[model samples]
Target: MSKFDKALTAIEETVNGALLLSATLLLFINVILRYVFTSSTTWAEEAIRYAIVWVTFFGASLCARNKMHVGIDIFIQMAPPLIKKCLLAFAQLTAAFFTAFITYFGWVSTELVIETAQKSPAMLMPMWIVYISMPLGSALMTIRFVAAAVAILRDKTTGAEVKNEDAVDISRL
Candidate 1:
């Protein structure tokens, strides 16, 4: 991968890993506190929930980067090489358009939340911070989709296929 792609992958992986790990640890601590001390932080659950939300969004981008999204590829698999390439490109472009739509509306929703000064009940944290994840994640996914579409088109021109090493072969299972 190029340096930019490597950097983006690193950032996404690190953020997702950290958020997941932190949420797990926080939940464990909350359980211990409630069981052993008969008490727990009121905001722990809310914090964990928000962390999970962030992780889900960031993880979606990683899924796109790795080409791990589920799809019915039987027809594409059976098609001629040129037709398959075109179909794949079309799929990527469609995903890009969908994500772009989400990003635009998400940003608008987040802005509205910010303007209303909405806050979480448990933690009193600004709701916009949580809502912002939608736009950010969708934006990142849009970038990934555009990149995938470009790579697909470029491969068609150069007679090369994009190879993703992280893809799982479920049939092997």
Candidate 2:
């Protein structure tokens, strides 16, 4: 993989790993406290919720990186080669546009939350911290999608197939 690819992969893995670790630790602590002390802290719930949001956002980017997102390919399989390429290009463009939209709005929403000084009810954590994940994740996903689209276009122009490591195996599916 190129350096850029490695850097992106590393960032994704780090985010995913941190979120997973946080979720696991918080849940474990919550369980232990509830079972052993017969009391639970509300902060644990908030922590877990935020961790879940982070996981989801980063996970979506991971999905884009892997090309594992849901799509209908039945018609593409039957279409002429040139038509299929056009259709795929269109699909990628649509994805890029939507992701960009989300990123823009997410950043705005996060800033609004920050400016409003919103806090989580249970943990008293700043709402912007959680909301910030929205834009951050969408940005990551956008980057990944852009890279994939570029690769696809390059492959098409060069008469080479775009190979996705995580492409679904129909027989297994």
Candidate 3:
């Protein structure tokens, strides 16, 4: 991985690490308060919900960066060398295109939310803040996928097929 990729990954890790830690702590405290005191912070649930939404979008980008998204790689793994290279190239390019398409629509939705000045009932936070994640996450994912595709093409041109160690194999767990 390049230094630039390392920097971006570190930033994503910091943001998501803080988000998950805070959300977990908030929920734990909220549960304790509701049960022990027979009362709840009115904004706790809303805060947790928003935190989860933020985490999910950001986490997805992290997953994209790591190439951890679920993939049925059985076929690719079994294919002949040249065919496998072609398949991998096709898949990476396809993912980039798909994410860019989603980002475009997500931006449209974000604009609508911003223009309408929608507010959440609990905290009256501008809904655009939450809506912005959709485009932001998809855009981040698009960039990652494009990078992956370019890397694959470059490697293929140079006759290299580097395995991604970061790709999660969930069956092991």
Candidate 4:
């Protein structure tokens, strides 16, 4: 893999690992407290909720990286080569544009959260930290979408199938 690809993969993996560990620890603690101490900390639930939000954002980015996002590929598979190429380009462009739009609004949302000094009710943590995930994830997915689009264009122009890092069988989708 290229260095860029490798770096992106590493980042995704790190985020995934951290989020998983946080979720696991929070849940474990919650369970232990409930069963053993008969008392639960309010912060634990908020922690889990924040972890979940992070997971959702990063997981979406990971899905983009892996090309595992939901799609109606059956129709694309049946189309003629040129049509398939067009369809692929259109899809990639749409994704890129949408992500870019979301990234802009996400930044605005993050700023609003920060400026307002929003805080989680239970944990009392800055809400901007959670809101920041929106722009970050959208930006990453935007990059991934652009890469995929370039690969598609290269394939169409050179008649070479670009090997995708996350390529897999349709069954897995």
Best-fitting candidate, scored by TM-score:
1
> Given candidate 1, what's the lDDT at residue 74?
56
Sliding window of 10 residues with minimal summed lDDT for model 1: 156-165
**Mind giving the per-residue lDDT tens digits that candidate 2 earns over 37-92?**
99988789888889899889989999888887787875555566666666666667
TM-scores, all models, native as reference: 0.89, 0.88, 0.87, 0.87
Query: Which residue pairs collide in model 3, if any?
Result: none
Q: Against the correct fold, how does model 4 do in TM-score?
A: 0.87
State the weakest 10-residue window (summed lDDT) of model 3.
156-165
- Candidate 4, position 141, lDDT: 88
Flag the better candidate by TM-score, 1 or 2.
1
lDDT of 4 at 134: 88
What's each prediction's clash count? 0, 0, 0, 0
- What is the model-wide C-alpha lDDT for candidate 1? 0.87
Segments in model 2 whose C-alpha atoms lie over 4 Å from true places: 156-173
Residue 78, candidate 1: C-alpha displacement in angstroms: 1.6
lDDT of each: 0.87, 0.81, 0.80, 0.81
Model 1 Cα displacement at 57 (Å)?
A: 0.6
For this target, which candidate reaches the highest lDDT against the unseen true structure?
Answer: 1
